[model samples]
Target: MERDRGRYVPGGRESAHQADYLELFFDLVLVFALNGLVNRIVPALTTDDLNVRWAALFQTVVLALPLLWLWTTTGHITSRFDPRRRLIQLVVLISALGLLIMGTSLPYAFSGRGLAFALPYVLLQAGRPLLFIFTLPVGDAVRALYLRSAIWFAGSAVLWIGGALTTEWRRVVLWTSAVAVDLIGARLNWPVRGLARLPASAWAVERGRHLPERYQQLLLIALGETVLALGISYTNEPATTETTIGLLTAYLTTVLLWRVYYHRSGEMLGEALDSVRGRNNLGRITGAAHIVMVFGIVATAIGYKLVQQHALDRPFPLWVVVILGGPALFLWGRIRLERVVFDRLSRRRVVAIVALAVLMVPLAFTSALVAAIAASVVLFGVAAADARRSAGRPPEAPAPPA
Candidate 1:
């Protein structure tokens, strides 16, 4: 095959890059998909036996990994493709419909609905890149990148379909490996002998701006889930003093999450990511962190629902996982993202992560609602202290690293 060496010019710069409406609409599917996944696993958290509940939830999360990979990668696809075209918009809508079908399959994903999930997933992974390849004008670097991406997606789709054809532990083992391959391949830019690995930035100058915005928006949607879960849970039953307290604490937890990322710190991190001209490690880390961060938000949403049921009353051991584990995961992802982008540690976040971990031990003895409050309060302190400290400093203006 002759390569279009002259034809494949890199992306051109524009005044500004913002996520289009199609991108936002596409992200809406992921939010709902996560809700379905949570609905499947979280109810089991009420089980009195900690060991049983842990096993059940872990199994459910493992099953949910494919959908998370689907969500993240789909975002990457749209970020590269020109969503302005009617066909691209149609493709995105169809992808969203596929996700809805996948969401329906998630509750029984480890069992009878395996094919139900895998069929749509295989269709999206195999079909999406082809759509973009044909839609994009010939000679674009992004088109070439998608061509490389399609190869890996095709390889992963084989395992996905194979898993769906099997039963029991074999299905779980196969699908888990499939998700791992999908994630690893994307991270490596689907490296193969003879094909050059394009620096993530080479695909689009504007992508650095667009990709982080997409992730931040996804995180915002995940936070909104926490609020929605609290509202619906409270409305179905009569409110009590404890319920009110739980609601307030849940609301604060959501806000603290918002402040932690959306505040000045998030801007600083974005600039830092932009500064690194090549070797898109920031994009890779941001993509991976979004998974952990959003999963944590979903976990926290699950914890809030349980907290609503037993507000202010410590009743079960699994609440520790439902409550503390969410914040711990979110903080862990947050700290890692900062470490990569800013290359400077936030001692406050480090403390918050540590405190959340250690506090889990003592808070495990208390009510789920109490544990929820305790965890959020730790973040509250971190956000407040950081705000007070950064109030006087000028915004960071780091030069692009050589």
Candidate 2:
């Protein structure tokens, strides 16, 4: 493939390292693994069993740490190194294997399955950082970034191993601390040198087309996971007319959320991140913002599952509130990130946020299903307005090749 050198422009092409297909595939695997774990856990939530909820939550938190860490590091590395290289391929494959092990350990992380889960996760968490520390050449600033990152990874590995050997609650606490430290440390350290300095060549390697493509693909994976959650819930229940409508509403809400993300603000946000002075700020804005967005997505998916289960039978006022309100939070982050508010709030989004809030009052007195449907409609409206507004403006053009 002829390299499009133009795609290497600063603030225009930092995303160049993202491998869309590979990222999508990786996310797909993660979704399946997560879904498997969720399937095991959701039943406990429905039963109102506190023990089950705690166990499931512990498992989810433990399993999520390594996967998210890997995801963040993978994008960072891929942005810096050419994915087409043989050495990079080997590293990615090894990382993938580690991720697979982490994903598989979800259900067992906190339960009687402790050893089964913790061991592989230890391997996965430690593998990439170790590999990058040793294999990547010195002198390059990127090497320094990895070396710093490896410090956090090593700390996390110690906690993981310590957690694995401990009693139940202590295990959760240890692993949580490990993940928390890694997360906070990365924010404090990793992007400091290269991203802060913003050398044109390094910036080109970090923010070009590949990175944006990876971000876009990952967002899709998140949306797809939401859809999958909805499908699973809808299929398991007895399908009635109300259930069908509720399912459709939930699905439409997901679609609208996806539209708002991809159509309205994704590219512009990418451009903005690229234009930022340091890779550190870019990493903070793009990398950190996406993590927040994904959390909202995961919350929305959980909300969707709740909606599908209750939409026909016993939709609670809270369920209605969460389903509609969740997307608003997601879009709010996007709007904040884009700095596009006050330009013109889409009539639909305004309605969605307001309508959902308004409906919640009546929902307190009436049917849960009524509240859910209203909230869904309002969210869809908000997403549509945002999408239209984004579509109207042209994305910032890519800069000239350096």
Candidate 3:
């Protein structure tokens, strides 16, 4: 079969070019900005004022949806389109601006000023898909994917716009429904004109390094944001020796988590993904692993906040359990993907689980900050050791050329 050069160029060596570090750096800036805004707003939700609490929750979900969408969309586009292109850079710039607007509008969205937030967000949300649709010379199959994506974006925009017009709970419901529609459409394999069919070729040989690097970088930014939140919280509170140690422990935990992930697992997953021959499984695994990783990170952030709030006033054993458990869950989730232990328990994973269980006891007795950080490190350390042991063995050659 002849390769279509115009739509699909082949023979690009899957070299491990260093990830576009600059792109990631810019993304981190946006992430930190947004995180700062969220840290400011979320605490109000727990305040004694019921109105503030309700308003905070409303604004948080409203802002969070667009932020999540932007990250996911940019990561997807960057994976497929060459970020070095002028057009792509412009789209990224617009998205960044949209993020800035979204960040600024968070405190105001629930006070019937949502349109101020929603309009820019819609622009950011719509711009990337539209740009990619017109610019990237993708084949019919991939174009179909974009079209479906566009429909989802349109639906989401409608809900977002509607939410801005009215502060009623119904608008929130509508926006949520729109998000659901997009999610379900993708899950159900709903087709769009010109791009419903999944192209095995587009993804099969496409560079895995690019996408995985984006994933890793985003995770790092999320961790950094959490640490920033911890710092701010610690500074505002009375600084005691315990608080100081807790703060340092929180930072160490974040560092150890990074070391374990990058050192032990990231490269292995990248190599495994690159070696795969088709796009479907690789995309699914990549997507799933990423979700689990981010979920864990977000959970850790929440845990960090909880630890900071409770460190001086209350015993936070449960919060401690959560912070430590968050990363353990993340690591275990990754291990499940790596070892293909979908339905059955693998020996190594069982051992990892047992290690986690052992850590839980200490976690129950320590400060939330200490326990959470210690647990994350322990989980990462176990996984790293396991990965190293596996790496040392020689590969068995293909059996005598069959």
Candidate 4:
């Protein structure tokens, strides 16, 4: 396997080790897409009928997946290429503008404006690689990878745009096909004709920091939006006791969720990724795991808003999916990450997930505040147990490349 080596350039920051300004600015733009997604879902989800709420939530997830994947794939480009380059920065700007329009159209995406949402997605995902192919110099291996990726995105775009032009159930089927194709390409690393398999030498995180840092920034955005949802909930309604307790409970839950992952889980995964820099399988597992983790955070954000809106002591039955299921999904992701990173299963973590699942039936009858608080306590238990387990182990280093 190749080591941490790069070509030298005189008088350039190409060798600089941290994220640059243009990348940070681009990250800021993507959050508009995230905020727009939650804004659309929560109101639809809060309807009085159970079946309607379920349908709304189901559709919300479907719409949000492609948006998330678009941003993730864009991140892949910025992470791999030199965004500091003049041409690369221009492409990044163009993609961000397309995404902003897509974000604004989220509420109407499934209604009348499906094509509005679809076109920007197609342009951003399919056009990005096409832009790079012509601008990047010849004989570069990374450029060849760009060609392979463009092929994947172009094929997926056909399904995406076709789905957008349809309505109702057929739209769902076609969009699913598009997402499935994209996921399969990623899962298999888009192994088309003669592109070098990656984390190419350019994409490796030498200090084991860049890749995780980018993901962590997104995680921060997720957590910040959770807190924002709590604020929005509080503002929209009267500040009575139920509202106060619900907000407090959600605030605590967000903090614990942050502690559970960022405290130990993220650092360990970053180091593990560094260990197997050029090995795509380990990196894919870790990246896929974080995607699940982000979804859990997004789910929890919606639950917090619902918690505030419910009548006191009346059951918030959907708490089963959001309050309980969110943490469960996160722990599931964490367990997968740790198994690969530490080479051992954390039994307490697994037990905590099962316990949360068992508690869901009872939680469905409880007040939202009680439900949020209960899940928070359970996560604390898992984090505590993992801390104890770590006390007897060697201080972490990336597992040496096998």
Q: Note the Cα lDDT for every prediction shown.
A: 0.73, 0.60, 0.60, 0.72
- Candidate 1 lDDT over 1-402, as tens digits, reads 122443322233242266788777777777778777667766777776777687677767776677777776666655654555455567778888888899888878877888889999888887877765765566556666777878888998888889988986788778778888877776667776776655443223244476677778888888876777778888875698888888899899999988887665455655766777663655666666777888788889888888888786675656786688888788778876676566667688888888888887788777887898898889899889878987889865643333
Error of 3 at 316 (Å): 7.3
Weakest ten-residue segment in model 4 by summed lDDT? 1-10
RMSD of each: 3.6, 6.0, 5.6, 4.3
Which residue pairs overlap in candidate 3's backbone? 144-194, 144-195, 145-195
Give me the runs in candidate 2 sitting further than 4 Å from their true place: 1-20, 50-62, 190-205, 313-325, 340-368, 387-402
Q: Please, what are the lDDT tens digits per residue for candidate 2 over residues 1-402?
A: 122332221122233445745655666776776565556555555555556655664566466556666776676656666665555556567667666766666666676666666666666555655665555444444556556666556777788778888888899888788778777776666444444422322123264556656666767777788888878888888888867886887777777667677653575545645554554444455555566566566657766676566664454444544555566667655554444312233345444556666666667565546655665666666665665655758754433112
Query: Which of candidates 1 and 4 reaches a greater lDDT?
Result: 1
Maximum-lDDT candidate: 1
Local lDDT at 105 for model 4: 82
Candidate 1: C-alpha lDDT: 0.73
lDDT of 4 by residue, 254-305 (tens): 8877778865666666666666646455556667777788788888887777
Runs off by more than 4 Å, candidate 1: 1-16, 49-51, 134-141, 193-208, 268-270, 312-315, 398-402
Error of 1 at 154 (Å): 2.4
Instruction: State, as a TM-score between 0 and 1, how close model 3 is to the true structure.
Output: 0.76
Candidate 1: residue pairs that collide = 8-139, 314-367
